[model samples]
Target: MIGRFKAELFLILATVVWGGTFPVISELLSFVDAAYIVGFRFLISAVILFPFLFKGGLFLRIRQGLVDGFILGSLTFSGFYLQTVGLNYTTPARSAFITQLLLIYVLIFQVFAKRKRPTIWNVISTVILFIGAVILVDPFALEGKLNKGDIITGLSAAAFAAYIIRIDHVKSEGRMVSILFSQFVLCSVLGFTLSFVQDAPVPIFNFTSVGFILYLAIPATLFATYTMLKYQPKTTPMRASILYSLEPIFATLITILFLGIWPLKHEVIGGSIVFFAVILSEVSPLLRHTTKPEPKN
Candidate 1:
């Protein structure tokens, strides 16, 4: 029980670290292109985690790690690629919300895996939260304007949602460091490869950009990936996901405090709705399973 709680706490801390990264990366974009950001972030992360990769025997689980790494890294790298490109068109806050649509995706995957339909409340919660996101994003504003950034961010959201599902498969097969280190290395290579198509600029070794890369690679990629790979498997996907959904709440606060970006009232309202809905889904299951009636006379 204590172990489970510790795992959950680790997951929560990971989410907090990730949520806090938005403003930093958003600021770094002034000095760095998105592809360069992705590549360099993973490069730093790979550097940090590479030494730990061999703590367990290199080939003791080489075949499994490689297989898992390729598949997970491919999906993860694709999500980052789309997201970085998408950010070229969107607001950081909107991008954060969109990426978190993975919560819904995770729940849906669990439903199918269980071979049972989600409860009516579950469906209702999903719809309510999704609708809340629409309001939060507020697409109809701008006085006869459709934002390309928002659309691109939306697409990235879907891509990331799918990637979260793919990650679950890889989490089960190998050591976390080995798998995550391989993932960072592969993703760095993959991002570099894709950057060519975009005519990515040569990296400039600026202090601010380098610092951002280090933060992203270490806390966001390395630590967060390790926690997700290690902990998500120990809990139900829905539970893991709901805890993860806390990212948006944290992001909003960080953005407001550190980035000087104030959320619209509607965004706060919508995010609250989503937060409550997630609580309902995750807590209800645990309550039902754990609560017992008093003994009959």
Candidate 2:
């Protein structure tokens, strides 16, 4: 019981870090191109993780390195690419709601890949969550015609879902360290390469952009990735999936408190629906554990 709580705590912290990305990236928009922002993020993250890569002769575990590398890397990088670029066109609420479709995608992928059906509670919760998301996004409030950014952000959610699914495919007691390193390497190489290909402008050396990049590189990339890789397998994917919903909530709060940004009434109502849905889904499992019969002495 204590262990589970600790794990949840770590997951929450990871979610908070992820949530922080919204504002940090929003700030960086003034001085850095999205692609270059991603590129530098991975570049610095890879450098920070360099010591760990060689600590255990990481390359020696190379049976599926390349395959896992590209698959996870592309999924992770493409998601960021889509979300960051998409933000340029869409409101933050819309982008966050759309990106969060990955939660549903994760559940669906788990069902097919693992041959496991969702419990009744899972289905109910998912529906509730969707309602909340609709409220939060306020689809009617969209700025422009459904454009390339919206499509790309939606596609990015799917890609990120694929990445999470692949994490399940690579079976090991916990090869998380190696797997993460491979992912970082691939992301760094791909992002940097694409930066050049896209003719992304060079990032200026402003204190704000540099600080934002560092925050993203260290806490968001290194810490959150490490936590997810370490603790995700301990809990059901459903639980992990639901916990991630907290990201948008935290982001919303941060935006409100610091930036004085507030959601519309409908958006708030919708978000509550999504929040209730996730809680509804988890209540059954939580109750079952609490109410189960005691073991015989």
TM-score of every prediction relative to native: 0.82, 0.82
Global lDDT of each candidate? 0.73, 0.75
RMSD of each: 3.8, 4.1
Model 2 TM-score, 2 decimals: 0.82
lDDT of 2 at 16: 86
lDDT of 2 at 251: 78
The weakest ten consecutive residues by lDDT in model 1 span 167-176
10 residues in a row with least lDDT, candidate 2: 55-64
Q: Native-vs-model 1 lDDT?
A: 0.73
Candidate 1, after superposition: displacement of residue 135 in Å? Answer: 0.6
